[model samples]
Target chain A: MDLSTLTYIVVGATFLLYIGIAIWARAGSTGEFYVAGKGVHPVANGMATAADWMSAASFISMAGLIAFNGYGASVFLMGWTGGYVLLAMLLAPYLRKFGKFTVPEFIGERFYSKGARLVAVICLILASVTYVIGQMKGIGVAFSRFLETSYEQGLFIGMGIVFIYAVLGGMKGITYTQIAQYIVLIFAYTIPAVFISLNITGNPLPQLGLIGTMADGSGISMMDKLDMVVTDLGFKEYSTQLMGSKLNMFVYTVSLMIGTAGLPHVIIRFFTVPKVADARSSAAWALVFIAILYTTAPAVGSMARLNLMNTIQTGPVGEATANLEYAKAPQWFYNWEKTGLLKYEDKNGDGRIQYYNDKNPEMAAKAEAFGWKGNEMTKVDRDIMVLANPEIAGLPNWVIAIVVAGGLAAALSTAAGLLLAIASAVSHDVIKGMINPDISEKGELMASRLSMVGAIALAGYFGLHPPGFAAGTVAIAFGLAASSIFPVLMMGIFNKGMNRQGAIAGMIAGISVTMFYVFQEKGILFIPGTAEILQWEGYTKSWFMGISVNAFGAIGALVNFIVAIVVSKMTAPPPQHIQDLVEDIRVPKGAGAASAH
Target chain B: MDNNASKYWQANVRLVSILLVIWFVVSYGFGIILAEPLNAIKIGGVGLGFWFAQNGSIYVFLGLCFYYASQMNKLDKQFGVSED
Candidate 1:
């Protein structure tokens, strides 16, 4: 079938699937709204968590970051996947055993103070709201690409779909729809990767192909080739560290792991399963689901790099000489050209467009030797690599359509889960738990829907505005999550002595310091002179002592633990029975032992 | 409330400590500090460090989760805390 038709069919079918699930599994009460009634199977919950965890950033941008950054970006793969270890071992099962609907509830009960819970709700909202903006932006990109609508129109359609599914299904509907989405996204991600890998390295696996020999019979390794491309183009060697020291990498990785563990949407998935064992096992299952994409991503990056480089060096597959003219570029080039991800400019008046960095003295000499002026590919958006892979490699249009739908699936699935987390925290934790204790189950559910509507609208507004950098902004969201909420939750679970005062203090300190650093660098939120305020030499490489502000979670969590301990000693500990409750949560069978207070 | 519950808690803490040590080592240790030394060796087409950053740690993470879950299940049983 034609590309346009296929795009509609795939997107239409996925939309129908979500609406069907929403209608079939509409949430019934506050219980269903919060925890999917604690009845989701381990496998089902795992799929949902995977879908929730693998946001538009993961689906749309991670591979692109990896492809461009090469070995340096491996921090994302390790930090994100390794975070599940923290979740499974330190958090998930106990949180399930605690049997609470929200992270803030645990804080309220653990610290024996409403103040701590309120602080938690605030942190969760900040982290989630920033994170949701990335998803909305992704949705707009996908819709505009596939539905052939303007980005603003796409944002509206995406929001409408999310509003229907999220407000109606709550966790119940999202669980099943996410499972379907996981399948769509994984298939969409892998098929093109497999094809590209086979074409490039004579290997079907991208992971192996990453380090595999070059098909060109050149003595240089694949990494060496990548190094050549960027260095030739006024960039650093692909494998060589362009920025950040070892310590920063450590802090950054820890931050991502803790942030992943701290994220409310993912944490709430543990509450959906039936038992403590299921919660524990479900984290394993979630990792397995996540690994499908995580494992393949680097492979995708490596293979896509190889494909792109080869395309520039030679004319498509089986051709010898380089094709410099705009007319001779493949259909994929033209297709992606419409998205503004790929473009060329003829410099030096050479018929062939030289794409190497003009600033690189060595590569400049090579280009001069070849009678070329300078680099010609002006704007190559990295994110397009995964989304536009099929078209690039001469794959079918249906495959390209599948990718569009897949990107949307990735964005929507994560957005729904995040919006739901935001809503539940607002309604169940703040409104019901704090602002109005006597709020009815029905009223709380209504509040949840209203909050969902509000959150979706806010996300849409940001999508229209869009932060300056997509991947970097998404990293900030992770940094916020890592630095703020994860640490508070960890202290709540492990340290009986941590009090409300300490938790609140730690969260504020950790989140604020991290945000200050990032804002100082980005100058975002219309803050004037943010750049001059926090000036440090080697700031790009050093990024707050070479710790990606994303590592703020470990720093935040550590500070929370230390501050909580110190403050608890200075003040009084949580009530005695709260310690008993901590003991109760430690054991697995205690899952059913504690009733919702 | 009883000895069994205390015993289960101790055992759980011990298991968590061990698993967490491995988790930290894989993610922070080999993948970060020792990554250069590890990268001296190659896997597929990438360095060992890069491989861990990309694929190996994730597999180990999977193993760690299941290991923790199974160990916790046994602890639950030992303390007569099993829901089953």
Candidate 2:
């Protein structure tokens, strides 16, 4: 069968699996809806958390980002994974001990203020809604490419799938479904990587293949060869290129790490595990599962870039027969071209494609010498790099189809998790904790379902019009989480004196400053084109102290720490009972199951 | 609040601080701050620093978590606070 039909079959089967799991494990009560009855095994919760955390950005956009940015993308690799370390050590065990249904609920009760919970709820929604936009972007790109639907149509389909499983299943359904998704996404990610790695470096493991010798018998290493090839074509060396400033890279990594720890969806997964010990180990397990893809990604990225570059350049630069002829392009070229993601123009009427760094003035001068009008292979969308990898490596139809299913699984699972987080915060924290403290269990369940539907619809609307690309936009979500949520959560657990005034003030100050920096750079609430209104120049010139907006979260986090500390010192300490609550959550003894105050 | 409980919390805090320090050192230190110097020392044809950034630090993170879990288990038991 053709690729599209095969993709349709594979994707359809996965969707069916998700819906079936949703039906089997549908939430029947508030407990099931929120924390899955706190019955999840550590290993299972780990797998589900892995699926919940690795969104379309990781599966699709990250390798592309890595491929293009080179070593600097380590911020993502280390930042995203390193947070789990912090989570395992700092937050997970204590939060699990707290045994709450929602992150905001924990904050609300721990800080001894409904106002604090409301602040957390707002931060969670802002970050998560922004995050869903990135996933929606991924869904749109993936669906349009594989399913051959319009971007809008693809988003509608993605929304429909999420609606069915997430609204009905809640955390209970989403958990089981995500475990299956973890398997699908990890395999979909690794198989082609193994094949490509083997093809490139004679090593089956992409992690090893990255540093292994070239299969071309060039005698030089893969990294060395990449450095040589790309520099020959006027791009930076693959092994050591930084994003911009090293300071920006440093702050950026810190933001992502803290953000990863603070993400409400990820934290909630820890709540589902039965014990404090389980929370710790499940975090480890989540990292292990995630590391499988995270480690393979760089190899895929570097090797795919090598393949992509070689496909266009064909031979050494400055040679007459170097460029690939437009008419003689490979089938994968035509296939991706059909999606309008990869295209070429015969610049200078050479009937050949020149895909080089036209922005590099030195290469630009060289291209001018060669009578090239400009770089002709235009519109190589970074999101397509991983999705197109298997095909670019000439893997079989089944492999390509599996990648499609994997990308969707990654996107959909995380979207479901985020939507669940938003829905629970609305129903459990907002409605029950504040608005209707006496809400019936059945009423709460219904509210959860209704909010889940609303969340999906809202996410779908934002997905239809995203502010940034998949990965960069998702980084903003992390920044918000890092600056706002992470500091307060840490303070709540670690600092017993952290009162309601401190927690609330910290969240406001941290999130406001981070959002101020981001909005000033991107636009108000990322509406786009509004940055000019702020007289914003660009990152290179305007980034404060060489810190990009994504990197500004660390500064905001610092602000949060400082402000909360000052505010708490100025105000009264937390009550003795709240201090007692903190001391109780510190130990792993006599921890009951998930409970509401 | 009690001595034993306070000691357990203290031990947990120290462990987390130590592990977090290692985490920062591997990722930020070897990977970014001293990457250029570390790159001079090659590993399997790749720079040690680059490897740490892209690959090695992740392995370290995994080890840290598993180790923290095992050690925290020890602390819990020592403090007579294991969930069991």
Candidate 3:
């Protein structure tokens, strides 16, 4: 079968499989809807958590970011995975033992104040909604590229698939469907990686192939060869290039680490497991699964860059006729160009593609001697690097089709997970806990379903008409979770002295500081990440201690810890019953099954 | 009972603090702060520092999770806090 038809079949089969799982695991009660009836096995929950955690960005764009940034991109790999360590050791087991639904409920009950819960709910909704917009875009983009549909049509299809499973089954449906997604996405990701690894380094495992010798029999190492190839073309050495100063990389990694732990969707996944011990072990399993992709990412990145460089720089650098002739460019080049992600300009009218770091002052002489005008390839969307990997390596059509399925699986699984988080928080925390204290169980389920629909519609709208500052969403989302949610949760669990007043003050202060910094830098509080260039330039040198806005989250979290501690001391300690409640949650004994609000 | 609880809490906190120190050492310490010096030493065609940044820290984190799980299980049982 042709590639396009195969992609359709594979993608169709996966969507149908998700719907089938949703039907099989239809949620019947509020408890089932919110926490999958709290009966998910540890291993199964781990797989689901893995799928829910690795968004389309992880599956699609991370490798490309690494490809361009080189060693600097370590912030992502370490920061993202390190959060599991915090989750495993500090947060997951205790939260599971608390044995309730939704993060806000815990905050409210622990702090003995509804106001604290309200703050948590708003933060969760904002972070999750901002996050889901990115996922919606990923879903739309992946669908458009694979199914050959328009972006809107692809987005609607994705929304439909999520609606059937998520609205009907809730966490119950999402858990089983996510297991299927994990298997599909992991296979989709690793299969092409194995092929590419073998092609370049004669090794099937991308992890080992990354550090293995090149297959060209020069006996040179892959990293050594990559450094030589990139630098010869006037690019920085691949293995040593930093993202910015070391301080920025340090804070950026810390921000992402705590932020990952703080995310409401990830935290709630632990609530589905049967035992506190299961929560701890499940975190290990989730990381094991995530690391499979995270470790392979660097290998895929460096190897893809090598492949791209060799394809363009067909011969020795600084030599005439060294660049690939545009007329005779490979099929992969033409295929990607048709997608508009890869564009080549005939700079100097040479009818050849010269791709290098043109702005590098060091390379100007070499470019002038070779009569090169500039880097001819004006646009190479980083998103294309992973999607076009199989094509670039001349892999078979089946491998290419599976990558499309993998990208969609990543996007859809996370999208459903986030929408479910938003819906449950509103229904459980707002409607049942606050708005309608005597609301019937059936009525709340309906409310949750309605909220799910609304959340999906909102996400879809943003996806269709993404703001220009779409790139800044990640920073803001992670920053809010890190500064506001994470510190409060840790203090709540570990420090019995943490009072309602303290928790409330800390969240407000932390969230405010984070928002203030992001806004002051980006220049928009109402609609952040939409900063125009002129305003962005104005705040260029305002970073405190050379820390960029993206790296200020760790500082915000520190402020939260201090403010909460000081406020709690100034105020009364938590009441005796609240102290006993903290003590009770600290132990695993007498823990009940996961219950609804 | 309160005495046992306090001791158990102390042990748990101590374990977490120690493990976190190791976490910091591997990621921020070796991966970033000492990365320049560590890059002088390499394993199998890659710089140790860059490898730690991208690959080694992740593996270490997995190890930490499993270790903490086993240790916590022991602590729970030791403190008579294991779930039914």
- Candidate with top lDDT is 3
Model 1 C-alpha lDDT per residue in residues A1-597, reported as the tens digit of each score = 788788999889988988888899999977787788888989889988999999888887889988887777878898889889889888998899889888888877887778878888888888888888888888887878777888888899889988887888788888888998999998999889888877766678876666777666774566666666656446666664623667767777777888888888899899998898999899999999999899899878766766777677664321224645566777777777778888877776655555666677976776676677667888889988888778768888888888888899999999988888888888888888888989877887899889888888888887888755544666777777787788777777777677767777788777777777676666645265666666666557335455655555566567656666676678767677988888788776646632445
What is the descending DockQ order? Answer: 2, 3, 1
**Quality class of the docking in candidate 2, CAPRI style:** high
lDDT for A43 in candidate 3 is 86
User: Which has the better lDDT: candidate 2, or candidate 3?
Assistant: 3
Q: What DockQ score does model 2 reach against the true complex?
A: 0.88
Deviating ranges (above 4 Å) for candidate 2: A465-472, A532-541
- Runs of candidate 3 with Cα error greater than 4 angstroms are A526-538
In terms of lDDT, the poorest run of 10 residues in model 3 chain A is A529-538
- Candidate 1 RMSD to the correct structure: 2.9
* Backbone clashes counted, model 1: 10
Each model's iRMS: 1.8, 0.7, 1.1
Candidate order by TM-score, decreasing, is 3, 2, 1
